[model samples]
Target: MQESVFCMVVSRTRLIQAIACFLSLYKTMDNFKVYILCVDEKCYEFLKKINFDKIVLVTISELNREDLLAIKASRKLNQYCWTLKPGFIKYILTLEESIKRVTYIDSDLFFYQNPNVIFENQPYDSVLLSSGEVFLPMYSKEVNNTIQSLTGNFNSGFISFKKDIDGLSCVNWWDKMCVDSCTSNPEDNKFGDQKYLDDMPFLFNNVYEITTQGVNIGHWNSSKYKFTVLNDTIMVNNNKLIFYHFSGFRIISKYDIRQVHEQDRVNTPFIYQIYRRALEKIINDVEKIDPDFKGYFTVDAVDDN
Candidate 1:
């Protein structure tokens, strides 16, 4: 059996969410390894104490690239985190010679089923990408085109790269591009590390786009799909929901969470309810580890109505 390897980058603010992501993955999959790149000392120290099985914690310094450090001060926290994606994936691919593929997962994602569904029939030498196209009927052609132009055709949240010539070339090029200038300046046609993914298919061979609707059901496209809970399993468009990206979902207080997308709250309340419970549990666990640790809790007011 081929080894299942995944990687993610997280900072202190996202520690709770990262742990929730790992726990979700653990519950859904039997055998897999996750490599978490800690973006801050606090996150690194906190996770080190947990010492999660099948999880490898790596510090930012361990990446050992002066280029990333040089521009760290100039980039925003999120931009810097975005910039680390490709380099981190490359580092894992090179560091683990025995592993054939490395999939990059965003810390904000929660797994609902075995992600092997995404990789099962994929070509060994291909780079797998999650489609970022919004499926809402509200989005006009012009708006969709603009979105594509700004954010690109793929979401950087879930990308799998095989340790072969084409895959290596794509990751290396992306790493170099990100190290050069990974700013969120849409005027420059650069929206951090995500927009660059638009060139992957054209620049490399065997770049496959994951067309499975359940693979990355998120706020951007969730409204277009029908979500139903059947026999205790979440189904999206008749397929078993694999994972959901909780992007922009913020915890305002212990009892208040701000679901940024109003449609998401309306269309997929069940998913959010499940995620909220998981987050509450993870937050309680985190508080036990550090009494004063408030992971990503904001003071903003949330509309309860």
Candidate 2:
């Protein structure tokens, strides 16, 4: 009956992220347990004060051999690896052996409000996939065709899985996909792990699609939803925004765009404002905590934008 959110990020982003997660949790401290699955032991010390049990440290090598083999077998040139994603999935599946249901979250996300309502109202299932079905162009035509051939849809990033049979089926399918991605069709920089989940619904029962913006309101190129702030609450297309995906996050670069040309397009002023605000808040908090926080940006090369 407890709600959970999981995030994976490097140690450098820990300070900025700690502030964001804490700000989001301040309002729902009693309702949700915020878990940051860290790969660095040093980062755990920085997160120690937030909530001990809430912050879990996991080495990246924690992803076992079978999973590693599956990903390596599916590797492509310069493509964002899908194998890393399966590693997280493996971690999530283990939770099923311990708990009922949990929400899997990326570290580069911000929650403007509590999201326990999603778990409270939505029926429990083996897995949850966020359908950008109505949200974007589905990106790659070839990938879409491949997914349709498999009788599934494309999604990653934000997912909810029930700890029962359906979730296991999804995990098993992902295990296979890591080795046999349908879009490994010799097309360079095409579909990576993003669309491979399209096959899960056809393979598993109780596999549901969550259409709410509250869960995954990605602020990247997909602008199916708009952001609005009212009375101090951030709303996505009229619904109060629960979480926002800072999808293009990286350490020094600040934004990480993988394999998409249009992603390099300058972020709209509105979107820039959103990130600037979040980053500003993070800087302020970091300075208050550590005056000598040597976290300011210093670029070796500059973006023309």
Candidate 3:
């Protein structure tokens, strides 16, 4: 089988979730390779010890971009992470001759099956993206509808591309936009790196969107899917779930995580807790590393002071 590389940006702020993301991916798939842009020194140091042969750890300082370093000071945490996506993906592909393709995925995603099942069947000559559940009638809330209307029916949580001319053209265009100005503002026709993808199919050649319903099930649209556990496997719409994006899952207290974005996520599915345990285990690991590790901002553990 052929091998491929994947990239994601991670930080000490979301260190535990990053751990769960890595462990889950390794457990679920054996085909794809991984490279992470460690957002800080501590995260990079911690990941180096895990030492899986398929894993390569990269750091922001190592990327040596003084410009991004400057931009970091002006952006909020979410804005900062989103802005780096395109430039970082392009940087990763250019860093190695053997790296011919790279897929960008979020660090909060947990896998239920081999992601290679998606990659192996990918239209290799094209740049690939997936649509969000925002289009579903079950997700007919005003907020979901508004965001979908602005962002153009796509989610940037998972995007893949080849290293050829067409892919590089997309990389250059996307990197320019993110680096120029990336923000949460949707009025300007850009909601960080994801919305910029809306223009991709029109501007670049061989762009493909994933239409398979079960691939990127996440908190935003997961409530629309019917999930059942048979023989210890979680099936959504009778298909094996590929991965679930735990986008807004946050630690509200020492031992509590809440789905802040989805108001009705209380009884969503048992699959939720399965990924939860993976994240909580990694949190426990971090606590052992330091009895006072304040690694909770986005996965924001409330200040127990």
Best by lDDT: 1
* Candidate 3 lDDT for residue 295: 63
The global C-alpha lDDT for each of the candidates, from Candidate 1 onward, is 0.83, 0.54, 0.76
> What is the per-residue lDDT of model 1 for residues 107-207, given as tens digits with 9 covering 90 to 100?
88999999887888675646999988776557787887787777778888899998989989999999999988787666587778888888889999989
Residue-by-residue lDDT tens digits, candidate 2, 169-268? 6776675665555353424333555556666788788877774556665533345666677898776677887766665443342342221223455543
Q: Which residue runs does candidate 2 get wrong by more than 4 Å? A: 1-22, 26-29, 40-53, 61-82, 95-98, 133-153, 179-190, 220-222, 249-274, 284-305
Better of 1 and 2 by TM-score: 1
Per-residue C-alpha lDDT of model 3 across residues 27-58, encoded as one tens digit per residue: 88766678888887777877786666677788
* Cα TM-score of candidate 3: 0.90
lDDT of 3 at 223: 64
Q: Which window of 10 residues has the lowest lDDT sum in candidate 2?
A: 296-305
Please say which candidate is ahead in lDDT: 2 or 3: 3
Candidate 1: misplaced stretches above 4 Å? Answer: 263-265, 297-305
True-vs-predicted CA distance for residue 174, candidate 1, Å: 0.5
